[model samples]
Target: MTTSSLEPSEIDLTDWDFWARPLSERREAFRALRQLPRPAFFREPEQSIMPTGPGYYALVRHADIVEASRRPQDFCSGKGAINITDMPPDLNEYFGSMINMDDPRHAKIRRIVSRAFSPRMIQRFEDQVQAVADQIIEEITAKGSGDFVADVAARLPLKIICDMMGIPESGYKTVFDNSNIILGGGDAEFLPENDEEYALKLLQAGQTLKDLVEELGRHRRENPSDDLVSALVTANIDGESLTDQELGSFFILLVVAGNETTRNAIAHGLKLFTVHPDQRELLLADFEARLPGAVEEIVRYASPVIWMRRTATRDTELNGQEFKAGDKLLLYYWSGNRDESVFTDPDKFDITRDPNPHIGFGGPGPHFCLGAHLARREIGVMFRELFRHVPGIRSTAPPDRLLSSFINGIKRLPYEL
Candidate 1:
């Protein structure tokens, strides 16, 4: 298995140049990578237009991605932003979520929310998930034809996570828009009506999150409950309680991370079914028994979170290629899932593909997607209901991909529910 370096000539701007194109165009680029002999990561060369002031490399191969994600010690997730650029210092100071933090602190924050995500808790939530999914499906079915993205996929995950996080149902629009705009503001089209307006939107979103955290913090203090916010407020590690900053950071994380990505996966999964009717048929046939594979395949294919970055702690050799310290590594999980070396018939969508080890959920390791099990449950149950209730569902209009490449999901999926 020989892996060749990407030549300067081969480095067309469109070679994984997701940031510069429309979602439709970007999906074409992803389709093209499927044909590449080996997985390739996108990077702005030092002389190229995009700057790497923060500094890192993009890991595009299946094996290298697995390595980079698993061994956080050597390739830490804390040095810089998970996306292509760094978050402003003040923004990071306020909204620094758990995914970016390294161990000890990362471990501590993870522990606070861990109880809510425990297997027992998750299993208990199955009925809630099913009920929510069923209700959403019923509404979709009643319409007979509706936008899957807006009517079904968008509402389910956001509502579930909002309920779990103790967020008022009314705050969802603010939370959803804020999450998308903040993470995806880089996309020129996805920016608010205007750049100046978009900036204001971002500020308001951050403030809303701040207010939410402070209010929830107070609620948790006065009358603790089993909800994640209260659990987090009450959690203690080595006699160290989560500070206001930490709690605020995690509250944003839980809301954003819990909602957006799952919503994307559900939306994208429905889109994939429209593309792969056979897989859809198979899933509909044996949904109860085969739902697990369908969920895994959805994560593998859509990979809503397209890439995660890691700054090299020191020089490292990945796939026999040496990367220097301070090099920014962008692990393209989307490309990895389609790697021919790891998956058979890589380009073909196979919901039943067994032994699937795609890193759609952050590969297999400690940082391997803490909310994965819950995500799976949500997707699986939704699909089961979708296939059963909205049997005739299909996309009525083309998808509008999120403007930002960081969170790769459909911004608008016009469809018949």
Candidate 2:
């Protein structure tokens, strides 16, 4: 038997150039590397476009990624959950949410915030989400055509997240803009010319959100509204609640996590439907029968978040890949979603795909998405409304994707109904 091998260059997962290609092209590259021992390591180039680190392993196979997520004790996310070179400690802490933390800290935050996402609360939010989706559809219904990213895909999640937080309707755009900038990173469409201007814009965006949340938290404490913000502000476990900064960070996480990723998944749904009209027909034929599967497949196809980082807490071997304590690795969720071994016709968009275990959300771990149910509900509701309200809706052109390695985002997508 022959052991598969990979030239370091072929598997340099950190290369910005690698991510610059079409996602399909990037997936093909991962497929080409599949035989190179399930998990392969590569040292990234120094001082490139993105934050650079010493080196990291690429977990491209389905089994490898599942194992990494299953064993969070060994593959920890407390350090960072992104692939941005070497993120500064301050920045990481500022951007870090429960998703970026490991046990105890991650557990504590998760438990507290989990309160806001109870089934009863989510059920109540559903009617609001449906109304928001209708409002968004109404705003664009007569246009007959518009950039789906801005006009449709971006609206529902933005509106729902803001409404969930009890943010004033006047500030919906503000939350939407800030969430886009922070997640946009250095994308020319979102950031400024140089690193300095970009840094400043990014900081200002963070500051704006922090101040807004802080103000809202103070008001919620005084007024006590029936919303997630009020819930977070007053939430107490044995008389302990989130601090002002913690409240703000959690809000930021809610906006970014709940807004950007869900929006992207919705955007990708339109694009995917455009390409696979047959699948769309299947969905339309009997939405009740197919809605859940379609939602799962869209999340799988979009893989809205591309990958997450996990550091080896101690010397560990995954599928025979050697690792030292503190070693870094990226679990390529996008790649794993399309791994040939996992899903039949991994690249094909099948709405009825069953036994779909795609970790479009983080898989098999405590770090799994806290808002998964809400996101899925939002997607299902939005699409059901879209197909019903705008029966003739379709895209006018291919998407202009965000130029970032971390987010598999569609920056702009024109469409017509």
Cα shift from native, residue 223, model 2 (Å): 1.4
Q: Tell me the tens digit of each residue's lDDT in model 1 across 1-417.
A: 012432333434323343555544444454455455544544443423224564445456678889877778778777554545555645654554777878877887777667546566566666689888878877766677756777888788888877776778788887777776666645665465454576576667777887877788888789886666776777776777778777777767766777888999998888889988999889877877888888998888888887877777898876667777877778878778877778898767798999898898886555777788788888888888778877768886668766554677777777775
RMSD of each: 4.3, 3.2
lDDT of 1 at 365: 56
Which candidate has the highest lDDT of all? 2
How do the predictions measure up, each by TM-score? 0.87, 0.94
Pairs in clash, predicted candidate 1: 55-328, 56-327, 56-328, 57-328, 57-329, 58-330, 146-417
lDDT for 123 in candidate 1 is 68
lDDT of 2 by residue, 153-246 (tens): 8888888888888998999989988889998844778987576677788879888998998999999999998888898888887666888878
TM-score of 1: 0.87
